[model samples]
Target chain A: MNNTDIKRITPKNITDKEFFYGHKACAGCGGSIAVRLALKVLGERTFAVLPAGCMSAVGFIFPQMAFVNNAIISTFPGSASMASGVSVGARALGLKDYKTVVFAGDGGTADIGLQALSGAIDRNEDIIYVCYDNEAYMNTGIQKSGLTPFGTKTTTTPAGKNIHGAQSFKKNMFEIMAAHEIAYAATASIGYPQDYIDKINRAKHTKGTSFIHVYASCPTGWGIPTETTVQIAKEAVDSGLFYLAEYQNRKFKLNKNPKSFFSAKDYLLKQARFKHLTDDDINIIEQQRDEKWEYMREHWK
Target chain B: MSNKKLFISGDEAVAIGTKLSRPNVISAYPITPQTVTVERLSEMVESGELKAEYMHVESEHSAMSAAMGVSAVGARAFTATSSQGLLYMAEGLHYASGGRYPIVMMNANRSLALPWSIYGDQRDSLSLLDSGWIQVYVEDAQEALDMIIQAYKIAENKDVLTPFMINLDGFVLTHTYELVEIPEQEKVDEFLPPFQTPNKMSFEEPKNLAFSTTPADNLEYKYQQNRAMFNSINVINDVDKEFGDKFERYYGGMVQEYRCDDAEVVMLTLGSITGTVRMIVDKLRDEGKKVGLLKIRYMRPFPEKEIIKLAKNVKAIGVVEKDISFGYEGTVFTNVNSALSKIDNAPLSLNFLCGMGGRDVSKSDIYNMFISLFNAVKGEKQKRVQFINMGVETDE
Candidate 1:
């Protein structure tokens, strides 16, 4: 009864009410765009939870709250748990036609908040949990996080003469949610607004727990031109570094299975964080991406 | 009709009280001494005897975090844990209180880890007095049950929206069985009306809660939070009086005094040890020792007025608590000293570190506490924090 019944929406016909606006966020902020768009799809009759990350830090300043709809900041590791609580609390109150959603950063979702997210999914709580992946702990000045990709230079994983940026690759968070046999799971990019907005719509129709891992870019943290955030985000998806996929009914499906991927090398060099990647490092990243797509194409429907 | 009286442990009493209050959500995580409370609650939920969203969370951190979530929607929430679990959710404790969520939690007070014992001690909750929750220690099963109902009423008061923590000494009160009178559901419903607060998220009026604070207004928010705690002092006493009118049982506001008036030597105690201290006072009074007891029910609005009033006529006051500030003195002792410092000639006060890690605070140790205070006035010098009834010797 609490699931969103909103009809199919496109960017041209999206609501201009601006549920989330103002306060402070960097120019061309991908996370903010994802948050604002998700709120638009879910509508004002929704309870949103944000953790102690970039989105919350930027949007929820004292004396100035950016969200017009109801939203609260949760503990760094307890975002999913607190969201689940809001979901149950509404149901207990005999509330009708309201969705509970969470917007957390990569570090908040995959690192400190992983256990809580798993528990909420295990309980099948009626919540649409969105993990906006900017690849590093940007709010804390760009520290390395579990979702930080390989060959990425963060404050914690600085590239040096001996050791490279990050020794290992990013954790497979989307697949991990799929492994839980979650009610609904998907991966999207801020670059593809229609596809990402539709994914939020798909989550609204689901009866139980749903997870969406959206690849949101960080201009300041990634050392990219602010205006190029959407372009780089779309390029990452086009380069096969990030794939759009969905899982439901215990089955995985790729939303965009590219026939021929774009140049992964150009995508990496576009950002300053990855500009430090050597020719050999670029080769390794491309190989890793190709290997992942090979498995995804073979296994995913 | 009056509800039936049953012989039950303090934990069971809490479960009954929780069910009667009809909380909308209960976040449960299991740990020793607190296991029975959650188990009973789970049974009630499973049998459909209690209507609640029973969330068996992964850890204590989520246990508290979830309760705060329930409270954010203006729904009643319940959770329980002991020593290490309490320490684990230490961050959530402050989060809930600062958020002004009137969630009622039962903390089965136990010793913290190091030596790693699962026994009763005040160290767990006492160590976190600054966590901003209103802390109350129950002396017996009846108080445990009664406080569960009253905690919600006091905490949910418009003036005091801080979270409330009800502490029952591990194994002592939590596991020990005693006869408790259960209140009728209809009567309790009348006493505690359905929750209504403008603080919650409602379609009628949307609000942003638990937002970030900057230096420009951070000081004012903290000052307001402190003022709310101060407001709870009267609310605590007033609720007790109202509960007495409705249920015929009353907990003496924050500090319960037993024969402390016109006494020469007084002993201050917290949690379950208050019962034994009362008996010790009774035993000494027969011998004309002029000893008395002060049971500190609430530790956070620190009972400053009660402590100062009880100390005025006493020759010397001794605080027997299960907590230690490690190098300095007992945590409760530190609070008592702070209260006593306000008056001139505050008398010689001593801190007796007894019952550490669930070790027994024998009747003899209590008797000695009274004698030590009496002798201190007689010019027999002693350490401020006396390590009493110890198996190991300490150089003095």
Candidate 2:
């Protein structure tokens, strides 16, 4: 769906009612923004399971919760399993209308929490597991995560003499979720609020297991100014670094593909995580980005 | 009340007890020794014999996590695991008890890996003594079956909302077949009412559960949890007594004492090994040796008063354990001594660590341990801790 189409379908009466607010997140934390927007779509009658991540640490600040709906802070790698239990318990209790959602970070989702995630989806658990990907382990102070891009400077992957930064490409989480053959798997960005809301709404209404991988920016971790968080996310998508798409019923559909993709070097230069990249590193990154873009264009219907 | 007997393993007995209790959710991952319990539960769920949601999780961690989820929604939930699986679910054990979910889990006691043995041992559950779970070690298939039913009531008691671990020896109890009297479902339904809780996850109130707490308020929550654990001792006795009155059976409330009134020597044990200890006590009694046996049923609410009372009358006591606390004596021995230390004149005690990795704790081994206890009572010099039948040569 295009931006205009998304806006046209968006609910005008959608409450700017912030279900989560006044927490300890950074000034322009993309993860909390995505959670706020997603909870707005999910509405009430929703129980959220937050793992040991930014959301759990900030949203649940001991005796002072920011969430309006029922929420729990489960163990680091148990969000999916906890959500599965909540969904099954709700059904067993004859409260099947209640929605169980898992709000986890990239470190919790792609690395420590992947096994439980796969198990829940494979069981076709009736829950929505949303991975707010900030590229690295931002809550733990910019440590390297599986979703960290190649040549990005995280705490573990510092730009030293011999090694530039991270040496691996970002893990394809959407592809992994799609492989589970879940009822719904989609990618959304905080920059595209309307598109993100639409995907969350669709996921909420859909049955079976639904996974939404949201590209959330971390200004503190990326060494960028807090005011440009949304701008950086938009540039990441427009520059072909991050793709927005949905996979359902064994069919792949591009959600919002840019008419003319910007240069990957420009996107990398916008954040300090990739500021140390050399000319050769940028060329390799740009080539890999274009190849991935071409592959998505050819494959995504 | 028809007391129909069924020839089955302790694993099957646990399944029967769970079926009778009518749990709302059963989540478990298959592990050795404990695998049969979940297998039977799954079959019951599939065959429509048990109406419940069975979640086949990826690991023991998820199993316990799911069980907590179910319990948080005012449903009785159950799960089973052993050895490494128990260690894997160790993190969730604290959560279940701390969150006051009242989940019931059966842990087929097995040895921890390293040398890698799936044999019967108490190391798994004994090592997790401080995880805030009310642990009950059963002696035979019958107690295993009955305690599984009693565990739910004890855990779900409003005064004691703690999770319980019903431990049965790996091969001895889990694999051995015996004629166990499976209670009728209606009797169990009358015994355990439907779980009712105001602390569950709800849409009407929308309260945060299992939330993060600062140090300022964290200790108070733990104090409440500890208070609940202390309260469970009374609840356990009441439930066991009520269960006995209904089912015409009693496992002697927490610590089962046999012939200990005027005995000079008493042997303390847990799990399946208690049977062999009791047999040794009978043989010793026949030989005119004033020997007795104290089978510990519940370990968490340590039965400190009962232990002190039992030991105060005896001249000497020996604690037989399948686990060692490494550097310290056996965990049970340590707890018993801790309880005894409070008394002015406690009995002379010794620790016998046997059956590690299921090395047989034969009848001869029990006789030898008794001999050591008798000798210690006579003021003979002896090692405070002994590894029974370890086959290792010690330069004494």
Candidate 3:
């Protein structure tokens, strides 16, 4: 048995009915599930600061509060700033037992919210900022966001015969957070529930700024079958397209290492977004993913 | 307890004041004009005189961020910058204020933006006038040092949960040397109490800070922040008097009006350039010019009541601005206009854009600017604004 396969002990036997019932999450929206699992480990002592995005629009608002603990909402990109304010206020109030979780979407975290997030991390504020990476602005009609992978087709990045969807690679926010030499930063996917929980748990107990980038499949944005959300997430990690790793202040630790190399085709073929891509396109993506995976495997332990 | 009356630059006096303030965290990046203050603080830290966490941040943004962090965790935080640096840290400035951290910062007033040059100006602070910070401009090094010590009390005052900024001119006040009394540490201790964060993480009792704003009443939260800013005006005045009584140094109740009693022509100015204008006002008064000076020490929380009251007494006012409003006219002049409009006997204020991009404003230039105001009062001068020593010959 490996570290990845180790059974994580459940704190208490709880009913499975807690998984947001009759929710409005678009088909395969793994963001809701990710938030649910994140909060399960975070418990009730956490306060989630939500910036305007998929997470805020979907998870919050109205009679439907996806969060159980205290939640604070800010503008489209002011989550980090508000979180900083809350951190100061909480510290001032001597309420250090409670954890401040900053949950934002890709556009909110990677683009507009970048300055405040970077500033917060650099300052090492005792806050957990989780970016639900859905590749695009799924809340705003599937618009191409900063986290949109190089070849994904979206409303903004419409693919054609000559033109591809996005012209750039996915922005590696995990790497950026790692560069700050923060106490803890990890990349996780909803597909790997135990691994995701382990990373969240690690971040919860640590002091200073901790970041977790979770791969949340957007059914509407990615144009995938809603029920296959978990499958897609699992495939991405199993194929080494999205590796699970952790960085504890400059020290790298790979949590899950795929036993053998699985081509990107095994991952992309299942998704409708990549269905239009020819073998040549698939081969190119596979090469890029393998190159990145090899680099991480070689340098990161 | 050395009774040392050293003739030091305003910049150096600020350094002494910062050292005396005993901040646990001092982080800043060097910018034109205000570089000396940080340089001196760095020296003090290096020499073991001040046992402080001195972080050489990459940018003003980082400096403010680091300061906010230190301040968040119950550290007495301080930082200094000017112009571009001020704007660079604009986002952090608001956060610090909202976080209610009594973070004291020194902003060396310099002209901001295009056709940009490193020089004394009020545009920097004026641009961030609504950032929820208590801003105080000092005409000399003495006040720069005195105001900084007082800022902590005013900012940390239980009612006023906000950050404070003491702005002085780059070269005009920061670089220029003057005789300043270095008050005893005991006196400072008595006047400004030891730095204590009201809300911060404590090992004895852990706390969570940086929570999200409650979505239910976020508007009320913003309103509360606004109210806190407005409340600082009175708090600032009260502390100014208390500090003055103890240290014999005060900014005269937040807004210092110099020689403006029963005068028709009032010349308005901020920062060290006010000293030159004050001299010009005295010269004009001796020549029976009926001119006086209204030196604006506090820019944020505005001092609107005092400005409107002062404007009601004066007939024609000349606003000497070291910074321009860009595309319009003067930054201070624009604010002064809004304040006076609320009064019964509002003065005819003229915006004189001068000393921009570090242009030296001499005594003669101030006198010339006042002379133009005199002509305007007499109906002899057609132009409302007379640019003194400004490079131009353009037809309006």
Candidate 4:
């Protein structure tokens, strides 16, 4: 998209809202940026339930919180369940103006917390569940997570002579959520702030359970320069390794498609975590990426 | 309005109590023995007899997490579980108590799995004594209903913001039917006010809850929780007294003493087993055996002061419990001994682990326990800890 098109799509009131400022997030932290943009769309009457993750550790540091609104820090796998309670309780107490939202990580969504997340969505609870996927468990020092893509090096998935990095592909949480037949499911990236904010706003307006999977880049874990965090996330989508899409009413639509898609090798070569990949490994990754894009194209069309 | 008497099981009585309490949210997962309680609650919600959000959670962990969320929003919340289900919720239990959410939950005390027994036992609730919750054991259906109603008042007290667990023995009190008095809704409403607290998540004056604390601040928060737990003793007594005065039914404060006045041998018990012991005590009293009964009502506050005062004059005290603390003695026996240790001239105590895995503690078993306590009071050396009715040969 051109600069004018981007400007036209972006919300005019985007400003330096300090609701989530003074957090302990690392430099060029895309997770914190996603949280900031999400709160902007949710506005002031939003109540949040944060599970054990980078957001829970950084945003809520006892007696001093970065959130202007109330936020309940939950157990590692309890964000969705707690949000269900908060939403129901708020309605029971006759508070209709406030919104209940859950901010969790990939591990807290697809792995340890999947059951609770599934329970909440199946009940069609009135809450917005947002997962900022940094691929690995960044808060616990970059361990492998189910959302971690194949052939990515994490502490647990160290590239060794006998074994490659994470052997399994990312657990397609967006598809899983869509399979639940929820009212809304979408994927966004920090590189596309306008798309991220717009999807979040759309989720906030939707009545039932709404889930947004955000591809938030972690420069510290991904072994990239702090300044290149957004660029890396953009490259991920542009390379077709990650796709921006939405699901509603049993229909899927692609939100952004690069005019000339880059190769998965180009995206992997930029990050040190994938530096151990050989030509054969890169070939497999490229094939998998192409298959995913083809799948999305078929579904979107 | 006059109270109505109905024949119901302990689980049904608990459902009635919860209905009268008017919780705004009840999240539960079905477990054996506790299933009927949740089932009855679901029926109430479905039939519009109780207006609440009943969340059929996927697991006990989610049930507790949801209860905490409901309570954090300044609305009354409830849940029920048993055995492994309670163990599954252990992590969230600490979170609920640490966050100081006044959630009231019911625990149908069942044996923990290993050998895999589903019958009644106190091991589940007894093992969680240090999880920072107010634990109460009821002897019958009537007390189960009444105490559950009072639990909300004690838990939601501004001075004592802690979760409460109303424990009734699985298959014993939970499945056994008895006559229980259902109090009028207006009276219950008058006794227990609508939940209102500043510790909730409010959009008007937003504040952080359950925030992460560093080592420097964590200790103070725990100390504050301890203070609240200690304060709950007074709140429990006050609420019990208020409930008694209003409903014309009273359960003795902390430890209910029956005919301990000039008795030389007093037996301490908890849960439904207390009822059988009460019968034995009455029969022994008729025979002029000088026996009495002390039913422990609240386990968390420990009732150390009351137990010490009661045991000081007795020659021997016997603690009969269904739970053993593994390498140690029965948990109730341990607490009673710890309390007695505070007194310089404390009475000699014996631990009688009975009715484990729902093994029936017949009248003869209660008679045998009393005989041992009587013999100990007469300076006859008896075993300090005896596993009553284990159906195995032992050196007597």
TM-score-superior candidate, 1 or 4: 1
lDDT of 1 by residue, A155-271 (tens): 999988887798889899999999999999999999998889889999988889999999999999999999999999999999999999999987888889989988988898888
Q: Which stretches of candidate 4 lie over 4 Å from their true place?
A: A1-9, B394-396
A1-301: candidate 3 lDDT, tens digit per residue? 1234433535453224342334456766788878888877776666677777776666554555554556645545556655664565455434558787888889989987787788777778788999888888888887778888777778888778986677777888988888989878999998988778878887877888899999888777776788989878887788877878889857887888887855677577667666667787777777888798788889887
Compute the lDDT of residue A220 as modeled in candidate 1: 94
Candidate 2 lDDT, tens digit per residue, B1-396?
A: 457999999999999999998898888999999988889999999999999999989998998888877877778889999999999989999888889889999999999988899998999999999999999999999999999899989998899999999999998999999999988888899998988887787888887788888899999999999999999999999988999999989888889998897899999999898888888989999999999999988899888999988877889989999999888789999999999999988899999999999998889989999999988988998899998896879985
List residue ranges in candidate 3 displaced over 4 A. A1-131, A137-141, A172-185, A201-212, A225-227, A246-276, A293-301, B1-3, B22-27, B42-56, B65-76, B94-102, B193-223
Selected candidate, larger DockQ, 1 vs 4: 4
Q: Mark the 10 consecutive residues where model 4 chain A has the least summed lDDT.
A: A1-10
| Candidate 4 lDDT by residue in tens digits, B1-396 | 556999999999999999999999999999999988999999999999999989988999999999999999899999999999999999998999999999999999999988999998999999999999999999999999998899999999999999999999999999999989999999999998999888998877888788988898999999999999999988888888899999998898688999999989999999998888999999999999988999999999889988988988899999999999988799999889998988888889999998888889999899999999888878899899998877679776
For model 1, give the interface RMSD. 0.7
Model 2 superposed RMSD (Cα): 1.8
lDDT of each: 0.91, 0.90, 0.77, 0.91
Q: Which stretches of model 1 miss by more than 4 angstroms?
A: A1-6, B1-3
Interface root mean square deviation per prediction = 0.7, 1.0, 7.2, 0.8
**CAPRI-style docking class of model 1 based on DockQ:** high
Off by over 4 Å in 2: A1-11
Better of 3 and 4 by TM-score: 4
Better of 2 and 3 by lDDT: 2
- Give the Cα error of residue A292 in candidate 2, in Å: 0.8
Clashing pairs in 1: none
Model 4 / residue B266 / CA error / Å:
1.1
